[model samples]
Target: MRLIEGTYGIAVLHADFPDRIVVARNGSPVVLGIGEKEMFVASDIAALVAHTRQIVTLDDGEMATLKADDFRTYTTEGTRTTAEPTTVEWEAASYDMGGHDTYMHKEIHEQAEAVDRVLRGRIDDRFSTVHLGGLNLDAREARRIRRVKILGCGTSYHAGMIGAQMIEELARIPADAEPASEFRYRNAVVDPDTLYIAVSQSGETYDVLAAVQELKRKGARVLGVVNVVGSAIAREADGGIYVHAGPEVCVVSTKCFTNTTVAFALLALHLGRTRDLSVRDGRRIIEGLRRLPGQIAEIMEQEEEIKKLALEYAEARSMLFIGRVRGYPVAREASLKLKEVSYIHAEAYPASELKHGPLALIEPALPTVAIVPDDDLLEKNRAAMEEIKARSGRIVAVAHREQEKADHTVVVPKNEDELDPILLGIPLQLLAYHTALALGRDIDKPRNLAKSVTVE
Candidate 1:
């Protein structure tokens, strides 16, 4: 008899006892694949698409034991139960690394296609609305939502910051983002009139899952903006929209971040139209969303230049990233990518926060990357660039136009002010990729990090 303790979503396939296997899940995902004489278990369906499309998704507090062709399941309460295996339509090619050197590079280049995938069939041009099947909110209900709270961890939390900005901008909803880890432990007041969004690429992030469970337990509705289908958060949340960014194998998230931001734009557009947003503005946002794939492709063409820049800065000991408003989250995520893969000590601060305390750290040896959006805050961002320049700091600016104040400028294609983050972030992803490549770091599997953080 095998003893299974607490809720650590685990799947075991005993090669010694080939036929005997045990699977248990809670707040994480486990899929079981039944083959002719073999069996498989994985955290993601992408891993099992090669062998079998038919799979069983184990729910929270559920356990199953398999012996070749026979299987039995039991609830955490010791009651006998049954789970149905469903057929997935995902193609095997989705998981392949293709010809890229690493999964990170492949995923970075896939951003264009990934963004297009998220926007493909969701927009309704005729009615100036969006159809997010998993939102589970109607026109009347969406209009009634007074406030929106987005929760996530790491990269997802950064995306949530961007999402909250978009929601507040377009939908005019009082929106904000919080780290799921903190949100769950704070004894948050669950309001029925507020929309709660849990953003995660795997949908199995422990903190995010725990937050979702807590919200659900408190009788508050939750929506999941997740990439992986049939993940714990996806299945447990009242409803949600799939990011459809495909499988991200790299430890540092790339495509999922961009695609999730695009997904947020779609969500924002949907919410905006439900309220008093004019048709003209909604159409403009829709058109901007449609143009992202091409814009991303255009920005990626500068990879050679970015690589050269990375090589130039490869010897740098540390880095600083700063931006204002929408660009703030981009700075945070870009800094994360750089540190995660390149192992460089990096910090991201809001441009407004620099003078308050971070200004003391600026120096000639350290490089600064500033996001200068061609919006109302353009002058403020330029002023921040000047501040870094005053400290003799080398500045690399990602902006819609060449920044005269920056030492070097990487110009990205301009989009609407609200949509600028989606476009402005692409070059930084390339910057991180090329920087790590120049430093000869393990690009796909970063040291001391896993692709998914299943444990708290």
Candidate 2:
């Protein structure tokens, strides 16, 4: 043990140890699953979920010795410790693909239901706001929050971008998101009145976990926006909102990303109500939130059409995704999903930025996917589409209505402008799925990527 350093989750057993096993974690995750007269230890709770739904998650610098019917938790100094077992809400079946061909496909189909779970019992129709009991912040404390900063990595980092925008727009607070790895290493200024949020699907992501720990040590208020309960980030943050994305088994995320966006919407609503957001606008946003599940279903009904579109675009050597404002993040996420699932080279840029440099890349062989919502930016995006058209670039438009300038159109349902990103991003999930299917790429297990990046 003296020779060990850095992050590790180790379990050892030997002939001399009989039925007992020793387990410890420094930087990785370890969950102790409790069963009938037996205990199971694993890096993730999913491994022992079928046997038991009760788990005790170990903290950093914690070690445990487990037997058939008993276990003890202790610190590195050898003092005994205790942690209460918490019930895992996710069923064992949730981790399975059910009858789907792959975990990715199953997760894409689960978005509507997953979103509903994150929103259940949180909507306040009477007051036109949201109830987030986990925040542990009263109205006064919430009002004192002057700025917001979000930290995450990869997909979670992209989600944080959207969350930052939402907080800035709705809550009237200046907000932004940065890569967790960079945030922790850059010696960022931590303010007492500024609120920080750490986002991670697994909650065990080492970079994000380290960022949360650093923020807390600096006496800064940090909240965790994570899916997994009892995950390291969840335990370390001062308070947070659970994304409630059930069990996501696919390496390429689908449902969890959607659920995290929905969770952010609720968080934004809560913050907005505490500030200057009027009750009328609050009710309007709440109504729009209620319509999201049905709107998602509407997008799913277009799978066959999107599959055909994917086949049409699959032969392209590369692709570009373009959007503006709220639509920009949608384009960024779509670009990522395609590259992750289809093994296709794709790039996303702000629609306005094309003229700056990306316009040179547009050609007949290079296709483009444009997100054109029916908002204030509609005219500007149309102008961008015209630029792509003039360059002879084939355009696949994901818009609220058909675009005459584009070669193909995938029309999505219209929602409130603030909520547009959530609905606009849904069709692209299917597009990426079908594109991968057309190319015979692995949908569930994409090469060189894991579901959760536990290590740096």
lDDT of 1 at 203: 82
lDDT of each: 0.88, 0.91
After superposition, candidate 1 runs with Cα above 4 Å error = 1-5, 10-18
Encode model 1's per-residue lDDT on 1-456: one tens digit a residue. Answer: 236554566767777876688888775577788777667787778789899888888887888887777667788677889777777767788778899989988998999999988988898999887888778888898888999999999999999999999999999999999999999999989999999999999888888988998999999889999988877888889998899898888989999999999889999999998897889999999888888999999988999999999999989999999999989999999999999999999999999999999999989899999999999998999999888888888899998888888888999998888899988888888888899998899998999987767777
RMSD of each: 1.9, 0.9
TM-score of each: 0.96, 0.99
lDDT for model 2, please.
0.91
The true-versus-predicted C-alpha distance at residue 389 of model 2, in Å, is: 0.3
Against the correct fold, how does model 2 do in TM-score? 0.99
Q: Model 2, 1-456: lDDT tens per residue?
A: 556888899999989878999999988898899889999999998798899999999999999999999989998878899889999998888877789999888999998888888889999989999999999889999999998999989899889888888888888889998999999999999999999999999999999999999999999999999999999999999899999988998888889888988888998999999999999989999999989999999999999999999999898778999999998989999999999999899999999999999999999999999999999989999999999999899999999999999999999999898888998988999999999999999888899998778788
Q: Which candidate has the top score in lDDT?
A: 2
Q: Could you give me the TM-score of model 1 versus the true structure? A: 0.96
Candidate 1, residue 181: CA error in Å?
Answer: 0.5
Poorest lDDT segment (10 consecutive residues) of candidate 2: 1-10
